[model samples]
Every structure is written in structure tokens, then in C-alpha cells.
Target: MGANIGDNLFSIFNSMTEYMIDAGQRSVLYWDIMRRRGNQYLEHMAKNIPDVLKFDYELLINGRSLPEPVNYGLLKILPPKGVAIDNRKRPFVVIDPRAGHGPGIAGFKADSEIGVALSEGYPCYFIGFTPMPEPNQTIEAVIRGEAHFLAHVNELHPKADGKPVVIGNCQAGWAVMLLAATRPELCGPIIVAGAPLSYWEGVHGQNPMRYTGGMMGGSWMAALLSDLGHGNFDGAWLVQNFEGLNPANTLWKKQYNLYSRIDTEAKRYLEFECWWGDHVFLSAAEIQYIVDNLFLGNKLSGSEIVTSDNISVDLRKISSPIVCFCSKGDDITPPQQALGWILDLYQSVDDIYASNQTIVYCVHEHTGHLGIFVSSNVARKEYFEFASNIDLIDCLPPGLYEAVIEKINYDTVNPDLVTGNYISRFEKRTLDDIHSLGCNTLEDNRCFATVKRLSDVNYGLYRIMVQPMVRAMTTEENAKLMRRLHPLRLGYELLSDHNPMMKPLEWAAKWVSEHRQPVKPDNHFLQWQTLYSDLLATSLNIFRDWRDMMTEQMFFGIYSQDWLQALMGLRASDAPPRKHPGHDPVHLAFIEQRKKEILAGMDKGGPREALIRGFIYVRIPEGACDERGFEMIRRIRAEHHDNHLSEFKKTCREQFFMILLDARRAVEAIPQLLVGREEAGQKFFEIIRKVATAPGPLGKEADMRLAEIKALFIPVRPEQDEK
Candidate 1:
């Protein structure tokens, strides 16, 4: 009996071991299947990626052909239709960044910044460039070209109430701000999305990417790479750097997510990759200038940069209202980089106001750098809100504001759409609030200064010793081949059969589709798989955080320690004051004279007239005022018959619809209608302001008239001024 029991136990133990081995094999098979599924999805999506060669808009000039060459030797877009008929008060210009990417990202879809503007009846223009810039085209030339574009836009819409609104994305952000500051008269409000100005400012623990320059011995590598490219820097290198920042996403997570939900996420993956894959190149000079002046030197916001023609660029010189859109979650251009300049340039909030600058900023909680500009959800909320309330932003008092958009409900019967019910409020923000985000990190500044000195020494050595040899060794043909073989570029190019790996993927995809056992969205096994994936992603992020901390500490120890500083001849004192020649008495006099002239002009209208003009310029139409509506204004003026300000305003309120429907035509007809009431238009504004400012609500009739006037003018109240 004892022998029989022992044999039974041994048999059960063997059965258990076999079951364990089978489960382990199944898990391995599941992982393999998931990975293959992801690659297959990517392959299918790659095949459907839109070709970059199509033009979405028709271009026309009076003397040009029906289909003018889409390529302008730089870039082109399908010029948006309805621009001619749409109100030009809110002109939308989308400037795409030329940083390692081709054009059309700003209008890649129907739900982009361009699309939002088009839907709102704002005349939209896209600024794109060709694959190659003109040989002689310098940054200065581009700035001048942009100024010319805005000038042409102004001429096209002579009756527009306000100047053109320019929106710049990424690299284009600083470019547009530079143009606006240089030629402030040509533009109105300026919007910079995802642009970094104060490059050296970042949180202590968060942004280690900025340290890579110092750790890698500064921008000498960029120079070396450009030299190897034979006078042109392949933008693929910059794209590669971006990819290296997130290994898990670039290597596995991105593809795996697509594979696991290939049916649902395929379209989005392709849309993004279309823009990502279309890489462009920059002239060696252009790339060198950007790396040296903007990224490495941090000279833009510091007022240390000079244009090729010796013109100084200063952020404080820009008079137009500036709106900065940044994301806290953006690693490339964090909020600190976007907003640190405010504290760097000015000592106090009063200085900002004294400069007559209207600065507004909005921060999103968790959108990454790319999503800040390209995500559909971001476009719908942030871009849409900005587009709709741009006029309101323009009217905001000079100072800093944090724009907050709050959603509210409305009845369907309301004239405006339901989605439009959300109200946008501008809350005042203190300089301290902005400065709190590590703008006080002067230690980082010290380290970057050391980097600048080292980079200069390294670049000089490279130019003297290595650059000539590199140029001599690398021919244009070899450079082209090298570019084609670059890892980042190859990923896109390889899907073509020319790549051996692609052949198997093609066949494997077909076989899998034919014998597919796709899991449902809510399958138990799939849920477990997703849960495991999330845990893995979290683990990867934790590992990256730890690695970054170690890297940062090492960087600090090497460059920021006292021993290292002493060796480099570094001092703890702040950078020396900028040297400037004493102001020219003659130029100073001219500036004072201009200021006096402006004040005198304001005096001519008085506070009331100035206020009235401001209101009239921004007010929406009260009623259906078309071309023929001016007659009603004439009738009102005749009916009023008196020069009294109150009576003139009364007449205006009674005929609010006529003015609201068409202000341009009404303003033109005001002279004829006010033949007897010469001061009628000026008086009309004061009375409306009084009604708008009155403590209690106006009666129904009065309220209707007030609403009409409000529609015609965006109310600019003293209390609403940035505090």
C-alpha cells in the first residue's frame, strides 16, 4: 500500500510541471503575436500615408495661369477659398516651422489651425516654403518677405477693422515675433505656439535635454555634421535627435499601440507620420546660425542677437499684443522656455505695462510638444477659442493675462451654435507666478555660459583642423546616399520593396489577415494584455527618470562645481551689463516728438472720443446691416435733428441693427447722415459707454440698443485692464 501511494504522488507532480511549461510557451507566443500585429498595422498604415505632392488650394493672380506652379522654389499650399469674402478683421496667417520637417503640417487636416480659421470666416493665408530656399535667401530676407506678405494682406483688405493676426508654430514662432517687433505697424496681435525663447530656463529635475549640449561639448558636433553634409545640413539629423529623446516611444510603444488597436488607431498614426516622414534640409549657414545664437547662446530674449544686416532684435520693441501658447508637459519647449523671457527682460510688471505690451499666455496640462500643435482635441479647444475671441484679446489692457476658457450650456434656440456658449475669460497673472517656474535658475545660466566658451573654442579647432578634411572627404553623391541610409529616414523609405525586410512583412501581413483571430475590444485576454502594457510603460518612464537624474547630477558636478569653475576662470557674478553707445540726442528727440504727436492725436479725440473709436473698431454688428442699411442711419440722424450728444446717441441706439450689420458702410455714410449732426458719431460713442457702464441693467428697449452698440464695439473698460 505505501509503494502504490508514493507512485501516485510522483505522477501528479509530473502533470503539474508539464502544464507550467505549456503556459510559459503560450505567453511567449502571445507577446510575439502582439509585436507582429503592431508591425503589420504600421505597414498597412504606411501604404495609405498621403502623398506630399498634392496641392489643396488653387492659386490665382490676375496675370497668372489657371494652375500656377505650386512650387514657389520654397513652399506652397492650396490657398484657402472664401478668404476674399470673409471678414478680414481677423486675418489668419499660419507659419509652419522649417525645423527638420517639410511644410503643410499647419494644414495637414481639416481640423487644423488653418481649418479653424477658415470655419470662422476669417481670411486665412499659409506661409510655407519650398524644399530648397533660394541660394541667397538669408534669415533677413525671409523676415523682409514676411513683412511684404503682411503688407499685401493689408492692401487686400483695406476696410478691415484691425491689422492682420499672425500665428507662428515652433521655429516659425520666434521668426514671426522677430518680424512683428521689427515692423510693428504691419501686424496686429501675434500668436506664438510651441516656441522656445529663453532656452536656458527649465525645471531642475524635468528638462535634462538642454544639458545634452554641454555634456556633448556644445554645438561643435552640429558644425561637424553640417561640414560632413557638403554645405547643407540634412534635417534628418535633428529629427533623429528628437527620436532619441524617447527610445521606448520611437522603438516599441508607438508601434505596439497601433498593432493592439490597428483597426481604430491606423488613421491617426498615418496622419502624424505623414508630417514626420517628410523631412527637409537647411543650408549649412542657416543651421549654424540657429544653433549658435538661439539654442546655445540663448541670445534672443537677452537682446544680444543681431540680424545679418547689423540690425538689433529686441523683444521689448514689439508693440503688438503677444500671445504665447505652451504646454507644461512639453519636453522640447516647456512653459519655462516659453515664458521665462518675461522675467529676463523686465524687472517688474510695471515695466511691462510701461512698455505698452499686452502679453497673454495659456498653458495646457499634459499635451506633449507635437500634440500641442497637431492634436485634434487641442485644435478644437485652444485654437478655436483663440480664433473666436482674438478681438477680445486685442482689446485687453496692456499687461500679462492668463486666458481661461470655461464651457457653459445654452438653449438650442440661441442664434449662436451650442459649442459657442463657452465663455473665454482673461485673468490677470503676476510676474511672480511666471517667475516661480525656475526663471531664477542663474546656476543653469552659469553652466550655459561655460558651454558657450567651450563651444567657441571647439568650433575654432574644428574649422582649423577637421572641417576642411571632412569637406574634402565627403562628396555630394556620397552625402545623398548617406542621407538615404540615415536610420530615421530609412524607416520611412524601407517600406518600399527596395528594403529586404519589407518583403517578408508584406507576405506576413497577407497571411495574418487571411487567418486572422482578431481580439474584441473588451476581451478578457486583451484587457490583461493592455494592463500589462501600461505597467511596462510606467516602468520605462521610471527608468528614464532615474537615468536623467544621474546624467544631470554628473553634468552639474563636472561643469557647475567650484573646482571646475575655477579651472574655466568662471566667476559667480552675473553677466556684464550690455554696452551701448550713448543714445543719439537727435534720435532721442525724434522719439519724444513722436510720443508727443501720438498724445496730441489722442487729445484731439479726448478720452471719450478715444474710447468711442476703440469701441467702434471692435463692436459687432447689431442687426442685419448690409449695403442699403446706411439709409437707416441717415433717417436716424434726420430724426434726431439736434446736436445734443444724448439725442444723437438715442438715434444710434434706435438704429442699432443698421450699424451692427455693416460698420464700414455705416461709418462711410455717417458724414452724409450727420450733415447737421457733425459731432453725432463722436457723441454717440460716449452715451453708449455711459449706458454700458451704468450700475443697473437698462430697460428692454435700451438693452437691445446697448447690445447692438456692444456688438459694434468690444467694450474696453478701465477695470478690465491687466492688473
Candidate 2:
């Protein structure tokens, strides 16, 4: 017993020794990472906040040089070694969200939107802004600057296949859509990832960020912050808000994760911090407009925003295809907020068609808000597939659809026809499908409506009574001082080499790296340390949930009060706060007129039109079309030098809507379209057959439809002589 006790004590001594050494090494490494992060932030700022995109770029059009000058600029990406760019293909323009962080999250790494586009041989452009905004720049000036950039890109790629494909990340998504809506002809296709279009739409228990404005009593606080800044709003305030959404991450897990895996995690942590820590600034007018028109008023989708020129902004006027990529795990921009615009803009699915717009959305199961645009897996699969099949999306019929990307496997049908490891399908959907995702109850909408009303009242009172005094007290020098003193910035400034207190850490970390002795994974103390970290994170998460619950309850309780709702001009009803005005007479009449025109031209074209019409008719029952079928069609079109993609797209749109108007009549008229072109009809029929079978066997409904089309293409037998 005495010997055993001595051995146990010895073991404990060795364990303690190992843990102390390991902890010392990890501490050195972790602080070194933080030190590097701080240095990178300082360097980034010194460099005027250069984009963190992995690729090289050259400035093409600087928005500051435009007639309506803004700080934004358009840069053309220079492809890396071994990558080829085909100017003849559609150019891709990526606009990163400038909400708080500096630009390049959209192209921060090799496996990103820009990388995927370049790999596919398309020229890519990035629209980024500098750290400082031009004096008195407004959102309208920014939009005008973007319009000029697109026009310049158009001129640069005059020989390209079509207009530039615009990709908007987060906040930029709404801005891009607004640009496309106002200048419909300038955009080819618009892709918005992790963007919130309907701010009030969210699940009750899960989404807590939407309650922030209400809790703060609205944009008045934002106004106060801007005033405190002497005009420019520091982006760190926005970054701080994002951090507040995940207390576990903000308070402990993020730093603990690095400390636990200090050796391997430093690189990635530093890279991300390079972007996250580099905060930018927005003009008071820009942030105010966003808070008012988008967050509080929720006016973008409602088409209630009128420009200084008296032109109303309407999303339905966008001639380009709109693709929305969102995630269920994204608390910042939940799927409901990302896709609820369809519900807000149109009363039904047919309204989408009548408006002649194509909207496709994809909801990822578990990616966070940043992962939607930053994760390599998503960049490889979703962004790659989107770039690969952009033309297909551009040509899809005017309506709502869900983008479904599936990995190819042994069970995948006709895998040979798929371009990549995944096959993309656009499944026809309805407003009901959008509703299926989730939405707030009418009471919830009314609560938010009250929040908006109260916000206006509060902001009005603050501006009237307190603004002059605050403005009188603040100056540009004070604003700059306050911005530098922000906690987010102060941390970096203190940890950087400029601080004498941290001067020893540089050498300490180097010495630790030289003599690093990592503890074994199964070490008892190390195991306990990990367990402690987990407990800390879990506790923080619990606190977060509790805080969110309280916040939500307080917001609803205050906003849903009868007197408050009455004061806000709201009542408890089945109707939502924001109601879609049913189709106007002018739009209804236009739909009828367009239908008559389509019916008149049912038999207008020859073999190309016949093939497209027949294909649409046969595939209509399936309710989805995959990349495999579209690839076959593209191959066939390639063989015919006379067929331009633009013409092919027009034929597709016309035939698709015609069939939507009257399927039987459109199918019957296929023979009429192929009349006097028997040989061509036969060839086109064979092409369609190959495409239809490329995705393996069709269903019974599709098979029957194909058979009907085959019969239409068959040559009529001459009457038997004197039978």
C-alpha cells in the first residue's frame, strides 16, 4: 500500500509538470496569433484596406472618378497561373457586402465565387470600396456609380456571350437587385447569397437579431451613433452587433478554439481576422437610408421607394434572373428573411410569370451566414454549379423555382451527362413553396409594424430636440478619436507591436516555437482542459438563449400592446402588416395582351422552335429540369453555328410561356412549326430524344408526352395507290 501510494503521487507530479509546460507553450502560441492578427489589421489599414481576395486584380473603373462620385471601384481579376479566361463568355461581377467588414469575403480564398468563375474560363470583376467614403456620398450616388461600372464592363466585353452575371454577397445583394431593377437591361442574371430581403420575416424562437431594432427603439440610436461620429458611422458598431448574436463564439469559444489548437489554427484564424478586423466606414446618409428604407420601412420589395428623379423602384421590373442562396443555420439572414420577398412581391405564383421574372432560391441545411459565401465546400459545389449552369438559369421560364444541387453517385441517373460531381436542378415552385419554408404570423408582422411606428416617433423627437446639441458638441476630431477607441479596434491596437506591454510576446513565442513539446492527446490534464472549455461554451450558449428569449418576449409584449398597436395604426387581424396589392388592371391587361400575342405566334418558327416547344411540353410534367438535359441542348446548339444563345434563349422563353398559357394547343402547333422541314424535324426529334434519355428513363407521363412529340415529327405516309 505504501509503494502504490508513492507511485500515484509520482504520476500526479509528472502529469502536473506536463500540463504546465503544455499550457505555457499554448499560451505563447495563442498570444502570437493575436499579435499577428493585430499587426495584419494595422497593415491592412495602412494599405488603404486592400481587398483580401486571394487573386490579383487591377483597377478598371473607380467609382470616385464617375460623375456621381462614390468610394466604390470595379477591379478586374487577374487569373492565377494555369487558369484561362475566355472573354467571349459572360463576365462575372462579384460585389461583396460592405456592411461592416472590408471587401473580399466573396473571393477571400481560392475556392470562392471568383475562383469558380475563373476556373470556368469567365472573366471576373470585383466591386469593392475603400476604407473611407467620399464626403456626403449617398446610397443613390453609390447605385449610379455601380451602373456606370456595369456599363463599362459591358463595353470592355462587347464580344461576350451576354451581359455580366452579377453576384451580390449579403448587404450587396439588395443593392445589386435594386440596380438591376432600375437598370433592367444592364444585368444578365443576379445572384444573392445570404441576403435578407424581408427583415420582419423570421421564426419566433430561433431568430433573435430581427428584434434588435425594436429593442433599441429603432434608427434613432443609429442616428445618435452617426451624430457622435460627426457624420460617418463606424462599421465596428455593426461588427459588434454581429458578435453579439453568438455569445459563445464572441465571449469564449473563438479564443478557446485557437488556444486548444494553437499550432494548426493560427493561420486560418489570422486570415479571417484580416478581413473581419478591417472595419470600414459608411456615410451617415447611407446607413440612415439602409436603416430606414430597408430595415424599418421594409420598402424595397413593396416598391414604395421613389428616387429623386421620381422613378419608383420595383423588383418585378428586373429583367434578369434572380438566384437567392441562403442557409437554415444562418441566424443573421435566415431562409425566411432571404426568400420572403416572393411572398411580399407577388400574391401568387402566376403573378411571378405575369411579371416576367425568374427567381430561384436554394436553402442549405446547416451552413452559417458566412459559410454561405465563404465555405470552400459551398464555393466548390453551389457557386461552381451556379457558374457552370448560369446560361441555363438565364434561359429558364419566368416563374419561381428552387435550385436543388445533388452530389453524383452510383445511383445518379446518367452521371456521364453531368458536368461536375454534382447535378443541379431547377424545380418548379410556387408561392406556396416559399410559404412552406416558414413565415411570421400576422400578429408577428403587426408587432414589427408597431416597432416601425414607434421608431419613427422616437427618431422624430430625437432629431428635433437633441440633434442640434449633440452636433454642436461633436467634431470630426472627436469622431475619429471615438472610432479609434472602439473596443474592437482597441484590442488590436493594444496587442500590436506598437504596445510596449506586448513587446516581450514576439520573442517569447519564437522561443516556444523552437522548443515546443506538445502534450499527448490522452493526457489527463489536457482532457480536463478541453472539458472545461466545452462547459464554458455551453454555459455561454445557455446565457445567449436566455437573453434572446427575454429580448423576444419584451419586444412582442411591448409592441403587441393594444394601445401601442392602436397608436401605430394597426389592429389584430388575419391580414399581415405588409399586404401585396393584388394585380393592377394595367398588369392584368398586359398579361392578357401577351397571351394573345403568344397564341398568334404559336406556329411562327421552324425546327429550333419546334424542338424547344416539344422539349418544354414533354418535360412540363416532371416539374424540374437538370443540368444534364441542358448540357445536351447546349451541345446541340454548339453544333449549329447559326444559332446564337440569345436567340435560343428567346425561343425557350416564348415557347415555355406559350405552353404555360395553353399546353395542348402549343404541343399541337409543334407540327405546324416543323411543316416543310421534314428532315430537320427528324433530326431535331432525335436530339430531343437523346436529351430526354440523358437523365435516364422518364416517368410514364413524360414518356407519353415524348411519344406524342415523336408522332408529330414522323413523316405522314402517302395514301396507298388505289388501295
Q: Which one wins on lDDT? A: 2
Error of 1 at 657 (Å): 32
Model 2 residue 634 CA deviation in Å: 1.0
lDDT of 1 by residue, 413-528 (tens): 22232235454556667788897766535676677777776777788888899988898898878878887788876655555455465455555555545655554445444566
lDDT of 1 at 358: 81
Error of 2 at 127 (Å): 0.5
Full-model lDDT, candidate 1: 0.65
Runs in model 1 with CA error above 4 Å? 1-55, 59-87, 409-421, 500-516, 521-524, 563-569, 573-723
Task: After the best TM-score superposition of candidate 2, give how far the Cα of residue 46 lies from its true spot, in angstroms.
Answer: 1.1
Off by over 4 Å in 2: 572-576, 582-584, 715-723
- Model 2: pairs clashing at backbone N, Cα or C within 3 Å: none
For residues 1-723, could you state the per-residue lDDT of candidate 2 as single tens digits? Answer: 999999999998898899899999999888877888888888888895577989899998878788888999999999999998888899999999989999988888999999899999999999999988988889989998999999989999888888999999999999998899899989999999999989989988888999999999999999999999999999999999999999899989889989988889888999999998989999999999999989988888778889888888889889899999999999999999999888888888878888999999998999999899889999999999999999999989888889999888989877877888999999999888888888988788888888888889999999999998999999999999999999999999889888887778999999999999998888899999989999988998999999999999999989889988988787775467787745568878988998899999987988888888888888888888888998888877778764467878888899999898888888888778877887676778898898887777889999999999998997555664435
Each model's number of backbone clashes? Answer: 15, 0
Task: Superpose all Cα atoms of candidate 2 onto the true structure and report the RMSD in Å to 1 decimal.
Answer: 1.7
